[model samples]
Target: MAKGKLVGKKLILLGERDGIPGPVMEACLKDSGADIVFSVTECFV
Candidate 1:
């Protein structure tokens, strides 16, 4: 298996999911070894 370069990287995640929050995506990023320093999401209803 290959390792990722994000093993100790800082990230700022500003993501949206079809105008909604993407918790799953956020989790995936975190799982990839990124430390979320800031995050923001938007939702439309």
Candidate 2:
């Protein structure tokens, strides 16, 4: 069996490098019931 970090834990997304600039990805995650503990508009990666 494999234990996951996000299992039953509050989610915290630092950055979502969508290969573009915008809050599209962030919004999508929020709609999907994500906690979104932390986030950034632009990611370094």
What local distance difference test score does each model get?
0.69, 0.52
- Tens-place lDDT per residue, model 2, 1-45, is 324453345555454466643355557655454455665556574
* Ten contiguous residues with the weakest lDDT in model 2: 1-10
After superposing candidate 1, which stretches have Cα over 4 Å from the reference?
Answer: 17-22, 43-45
C-alpha lDDT of candidate 1 relative to the true structure: 0.69
Residue 2: error of model 1 in Å? 9.7
For candidate 1, the TM-score is 0.58
Q: Which digits, one per residue and each the tens of the lDDT, describe model 1 over residues 1-45?
A: 325998788887666757535465577787777777887776544
Residue 14 of candidate 1: its Cα lDDT?
A: 62
Instruction: Identify the leading candidate in terms of TM-score.
Output: 1
